[model samples]
Target: MHGKRVLLIVSGGIAAYKSLELIRLLTQAGCGVRCVLTEGGAQFVTPLSLQALSGEPVHTTLWSLTDESEMGHIALSRSADLVVVCPASADILARMAQGLASDIATTLLLATDTPVLVAPAMNVRMWQHAATRANMATLRDRGIHVVGPDDGIMACNEFGPGRLAEPPVILATIASLLAREPVPQDLAGRHALVTAGPTHEPIDPVRYIANRSSGRQGYAIAAALSARGAGVTLVSGPVSLPAPPGVALVPVETASDMLAACEAALPADIAVLAAAVGDWRVTHPGTAKLKKRPGQPAAPLSLTVNPDILASLSAPGPRRPALVIGFAAETEDLLANAADKRRRKGCDWIVANDVSLPGDGSPGVMGGDRNQVHLVTADGTEAWPSLDKREVADRLAARIAAHLAPHSLIRNSP
Candidate 1:
């Protein structure tokens, strides 16, 4: 961690006390630590303690007259390799999500383009609140990293999530980020076109056909690849997700629209078709609202097959993606179908998932915070246990990055 500077922001909560130890751990790992104490955080732990651990002056206020002489807040935050907030309370999280910069920590966050990680600490009730969950979702969409608020006993004697990650974990995460080797993408200069989410097929002007896919898994993969420093173009269907920080986004409503968009935004290094696209569309979609029939029956709506996005991407065309990945969402006999999809779609890999079981308590693939997945190669299948979807995305994107990496990149990976 030498030469790496960590800007540790301590937010108010019981967990703020841990920031001292976290600072010590970072110092011991050879990182230069700059401490920032939120007004509320200072209530639990003094600047003297944090200053002693970091061996640096503690920054407290956005408008500190002393530090303002040098534009300390901006300079301090921008110079750091990464920014971390321990005991990120629900209030702090909400403020960050809303881009509030009334204080030093949030101001530093908004001012710097560096990556941010937050380890939240709050009461079990506050942690479980719907408002908190929504805020977390929004933060994630904005490319923020979050660690534990691990589940356990809290200060109030209630048992649930919202505990701060211990110092060792934060230290390790910092080490990982510092030691992370840059991905020398063969697709580095080329464009990576990806499609994600369920396309809506209109049943009427008021309603439409769609799928239950949250698009979480696909969007996570997109974010991971974008972080690898690729020029990515995500032609997405309607989904409640933020376009990752550097990637361009094109939204489409139908399968044909997605196809047209992909073709128009083409000539790529690789393409991942993770969308759960509807197989068919209404032949004559009602432009006007279709009223419920009293005596006359509802019009019989014939359907027609939509364009096959995977097959088109794989076809030998001027705009064909060098590598194509297709997703197979199946209920039963997952492998057999995925194998067939690879053969039929002519794509390179099939990320097969089973969505039949939600809340089945099976976890991951079946409905859990984690996932269980099977990767179908031309040769065989590799199974991975249930983990957070983010982990899965990281691993898969690493694999795809490896495959698409150039000859020189393979030599450099080791």
Candidate 2:
């Protein structure tokens, strides 16, 4: 990131405090940073603080005579290699999507030719609103980059995804965006099949069994592979996450549907089984919603084993992928269980992680955006430090690219 210039747009949101740390990180990385604070943003952080860290004056208004005389809005917009909106409020994002230039921030965003990255932060309801989703999709389609609004408890005493991405995540994303050359297209001509989210097994028309998997990791992996030039087929269960750009998405509800989708996507170069598939489903599901009788005990439901997707994919066959990877979300004996699973399922590698919660009441891996995983392969187990799921996905995708490179020629041969 050295010598790179970033125009940091701080928007109004509780997460605006994080922009201070973001500026510090950028400056320390030898990148020049200039901040533009919106009216809402000014409520959370002072311009002096940003100016002191950036060693440059802050741009707060569109009509500042002295500032505009020196550097006009047009010049400011084109000055940076990248423009980043940290704590991008729902309002600002909506304005950007609609090409509304009601404020200096929006005007500059419209004027800039530089690539844009936005990190959204808002209430869970607002984040999940149909309008917000549509706006974000529009931005993504337009080639803008988005980092995250990670899931967790918020200042409003609510729990769910809407928090700003941690500072480190923002920093890493900035570095990647500002790189001189395009990201390596190492997976070109390779087909990647990935399954994500928690499969729901129906017990009745209105009831089902499911797990806590949020599908963030799997979605990130799909995005990473696609970014590296792979044709990705994502067989995803019901997850709130949006479909990654440039990937084919097959949405399924039950384990059976997920398995069928994976099979249909086969002859793939690589297969990543990341879904938390249900082990058992109702043997005889009710045709309609089950009813309760006042004097009757709860009706006993018979269960049957669901199809083993990972094992099936790893089965010896000509249609088998060159590399098969599975994820083990264990709460105890993480390494041992993962190793056993790898061997038992006949997969090439297993990414294992302890999803147990600490005594301090922190979130667990089942639904969070961060993970600490152990890569168990034939040679040995490699422990990776805690990282954002996106970073982990990038690292795993790189590894997959390297592993599949040797077989690319054979696969592509006429």
Model 2, span 1-414: residue lDDT tens:
999999999999899999999999999999999999999999999999999999999999999998678657889999999999998999999999999888789999999999999999999999988788768756764557888889999999898889999989999999988874776998888889999999999989899999988787888899988999988999999987778988899999999999899988878888999899999999999999889999999989999999999999999999898999999989999999999999999999999988895622133358764688999999999998877677788899999998877664324310
Give the Cα lDDT of each candidate.
0.81, 0.89
Off by over 4 Å in 1: 223-229, 292-303, 316-319, 356-372, 385-391, 406-414
- TM-score quality measure for candidate 2: 0.75
How do the residues 1-414 of candidate 1 rate in per-residue lDDT, one tens digit apiece?
Answer: 988998999989878888888887788778999989999998999999988888899998888788888998889879888999887999999999999988999998989888888888999889878788778867876767888878888888999878888889978887887777766553455567778888999988887877766566677777777777667788888888888777788999999899999888777777888888899998888889888778998778899999999998988766566678888888889899999999998888888877665652244443233467789989889887765677777888888778776533211110
Model 1: how far residue 331 lies from native, Å: 3.3
Q: Candidate 1 versus the native: TM-score?
A: 0.87
TM-score of each model, in listed order: 0.87, 0.75
The all-Cα superposition gives candidate 2 an RMSD in Å to the true structure of 6.3
Determine which window of 10 residues in candidate 1 has minimal summed lDDT. Answer: 405-414
Quote the lDDT for 197 in model 2. 93
